[model samples]
Target: MSARPGGWRRRWILLLAFLTPPCRRIVALGSRELDGAAAPWDRWRIRVHRSICTGCRRYLQQLEILREAAHGSTDRPPPTTRLSTESRDRLKRRLRCEPAKS
Candidate 1:
């Protein structure tokens, strides 16, 4: 077979690909990193993988967004409800068994 041009580039690409962890491992590491549970080495590997893997980077971003949103939902204050003065007085009257004021 004839040699292809830029074989060195392909070789370099393949070499780099082999050196990095697979996407699944990187994603798992990234999750741990986000949770502050990953080792420094694993975090470094995840950073390197994210630099070259757009899919993993996007996945991490989405995962982080979801994580923050999940946490944020609990931190928010409960919804406030208001009763109008008229309604409040009507409720008070009913509770006391008093006739409604005309």
Candidate 2:
């Protein structure tokens, strides 16, 4: 078979894709730390990352807010009204009929 143009670029793209996924472990460690299951080293690693990575800092803050909300400590009062079963069913049916969003 003849060599194809851009074949090396395709190989590099596949190599980078595989390599990048290993970094997700750090993000997962950060998540686990927020959830209170982190070891001492994990906490250190996550703290160092949070100190340097603003995105991770924001993510941790969001996790804290969500955890508080899950425990019923929301900053604002929840809606007092409830949707009727018929209304909810209609909404669900409408959603089901809509095309899946990207």
Candidate 3:
């Protein structure tokens, strides 16, 4: 049987997708702006990537949701559970004696 009329076109599009940069690269470019280190070229590339790729647009939208959630958390007061003064002091002394793990 002969190939269908649209099969060749679909194959060509699939080939182009393989050749083009993937969605993760586009999201990485967009994320640089969130980290406060965005370059002009990165913004331009992200805009172009978003124009052509719906998946990257959705990924950026999810990033916005996470950013908003983080911002909202900071607006709230700290939890009610409290460390007693003596316990807090002990913890501080232990922390001072040890290297910071992070």
Candidate 4:
């Protein structure tokens, strides 16, 4: 059999079609990534993503269980509430954008 001009193009098109993921899967993966120790707003975004993407619902449930376990552990303070004085000073300095005036 002789190859046509479009034969290679057709193979590439098929490959691309196979590699493309469904929109719901993409959203699910994004939600999974954002569910781990992310900010509150990021967690909210993951929740919203999960609401629309049922494929990720199980992943979200797993994340929620993990988060609960982490919270139950008393070994460390919550990330949102724990800040060293040095860190606080650095943030203040960055926000002020200038050395202390006096």
Best-fitting candidate, scored by lDDT: 1
Candidate 3's C-alpha runs over 4 A off are: 1-20, 75-102
lDDT of each: 0.82, 0.70, 0.78, 0.63
Candidate 4 least-lDDT 10 residues = 16-25
Models 1 onward score TM values of 0.58, 0.46, 0.52, 0.27
lDDT of 4 by residue, 1-102 (tens): 888989987777556445545546545555556555455654555555555546566766776787788778777666877888999999998979866666
Candidate order (lDDT): 1, 3, 2, 4
Candidate 2: deviation at residue 55, Å? 0.5
**Could you give me the TM-score of model 3 versus the true structure?**
0.52
Worst 10 residues of 3 by lDDT: 12-21
In terms of TM-score, which candidate is strongest?
A: 1
Global Cα lDDT for candidate 4? 0.63
| Selected candidate, larger lDDT, 1 vs 3 | 1
**Predictions: Cα RMSD each:** 8.6, 17.8, 9.4, 15.6
The 10 consecutive residues of candidate 1 with the worst lDDT sum are 74-83
Model 4: runs farther than 4 Å from truth?
A: 1-36, 63-102
